[model samples]
Target: MKKPFAIVFLLILSSCQYFEKQVPDEEALLQKRLKEINWKEVSSYPSIAECDAILDKELKKQCFFESMARLVQEKLDLDTIAMLYPEMDTINVQVTVYPDASLKFEPQMPPDNTVSYNTIAIDSILKARLVDFPKIEPAQKEGVPVTTQFILPVILDVE
Candidate 1:
C-alpha cells in the first residue's frame, strides 16, 4: 500500500506540465489585431468648427461635406471657368487632407483625352479660388491623425 501511494504521488507531480497554460505571443497577438482593423475607414472624419458640435457621426460627416461643396461652388462661381468652357457643368475636385492639417486641391481630368478643357488652367484656378477656408481638423484613426483624400463634385451654376 505504501509503494502504491508513493508511485501515485510521483505520477501526479510529473504530469503537472499538462495543466500549465501557455502564454500567447504579444507580437503575434498585435499582428492579428492590426489585421482585424479596417485601415480604409477613419474613426473620425475631418471637420470644421460648425460641425464640431454635432454628436452623430454620419450627420457630422454630411455637414462637413455639404459645407465644403457649398464653399467650393461659391468660390468657383466667381471664376471665369463657365465663360471659358460653356459646355462644362461640373468639375470633380480631389481634396487631400494631410495629417498635419494641410490641404491640397487638384482637378481630376476627364478620362477622355480628346476633351478640349485645359487641365493646367483648371488646376491653377482650383488652387487659387479654394483658399482662405476655415480651419479644418484632420481626420483621426485609432486616436491618431491620418491623411484622407476624397473627390468632391462641384457644380458650376454661373448663370
Candidate 2:
C-alpha cells in the first residue's frame, strides 16, 4: 500500500512540471542555442526606437550582452513578458533573428471561444534593431561569433 502512495506522488510531481511556463536557465539555453546559429547572414530587424531605452550611448553597446549576463548573475526580470501579452501561450516563445537584431514574440490574439471556434490566426512580430552596432559576420571577426538580443514591445490591448 505504501508503494502505491509513493507512485502517486511521483506521478503528480512529473505532471506538475508541464504547468511550469518559465524556462529554467533561459539565458544559458539562449547562449547554447546561439552557438548553433550561423548569424553571419543578414536577417531583417525592427527600428531600435521600439526597444527599451538605455539611452547612454556607451551602455547601449552592452545592453543585450549585459541583459544575458543575468543568466550568470543573480538578477532576473520575471512575469515581465507575460504582462505585455496576456493571452500568449508562452511555452516556447519563438525568437526571430536578423543580422544585428533579434525579436521575441508569442502567439498573439488567440480565438474568441464564445463567438467562434474558427481558430483566429495571429503571428509573431519584430523586436528591435541595432543602429550603432554594425552587422558583423562571423567571418569578419576571423573567429568571434557576433550576435545581438532585443526585447520587442508587442502592442497587446484587449480592445
Candidate 3:
C-alpha cells in the first residue's frame, strides 16, 4: 500500500509540468502586434472646428482636406504667386500636422524638371500667406497623437 501511494505521488508531481503554462515573452508579443498594425493610416485625421461635427470617418477626413485646401487657396490668392508663375495653374502643397497641433506647409515641386520655379521664393510666400489659420486638432493613431503629412492641390484662381 505504501509503495503504491509513493509511486502515485511521484507520478502526480512529474505530470504537473504538463499543466504549467509557458509564459510568453512580452517584447516578442509586442513586436508581433506592432507588425500587424497598418502604419500608413491614422485612427483619426487632423481637423478644424468646422469638421468636428462630422461623424463618418471618411467624410470627416474629406472635410478636413477640402477645408484646408480652400483656406490655402484663399490665402495664396492674396499673394503674387499667380503673377510670378503664370504658366502654373495649380500648385501641390505638402501640409504637415505635428503632434503638438502646429502646421507646416511646403510647396511640392513638379515631377518633371522641365517645369522650373523658384522653390525658395514659393516657400517664403507660402509661409507668409498661410499663417493665422484656424486652429487644427492633431491627428491620432491608436488614440495617441501623431504627425501626419499629405499633399493638397491648390488652384491659383487669383484672377
lDDT of 3 at 125: 98
Q: Over the stretch 1-159, how does candidate 1's per-residue lDDT look in tens digits? A: 999999999999999988897888999999999999899899999998899999999999999999988988999999998888877888899999999989999998668666688989998898899999999999999999999999999988767
lDDT of residue 75 for candidate 3: 95
Could you tell me which 10 consecutive residues in candidate 1 have the lowest summed lDDT?
108-117
Q: Which sections of candidate 3 miss by over 4 Å?
A: 1-19, 112-115
lDDT of 3 at 134: 97
lDDT of each: 0.91, 0.39, 0.94
Across residues 65-128, which tens digit of lDDT does each residue of candidate 3 receive?
Answer: 9999999999999989999988888999999999999999999978867878999999999998
Write the number of the candidate with greater lDDT, choosing between 2 and 3. Answer: 3
Count of clashes, each model:
0, 1, 0
Candidates in order: C-alpha RMSD to true structure? 4.2, 22.9, 3.9
lDDT of 3 at 56: 96
Model 2 ranges off by over 4 Å: 1-55, 58-95, 100-120, 124-145, 153-155
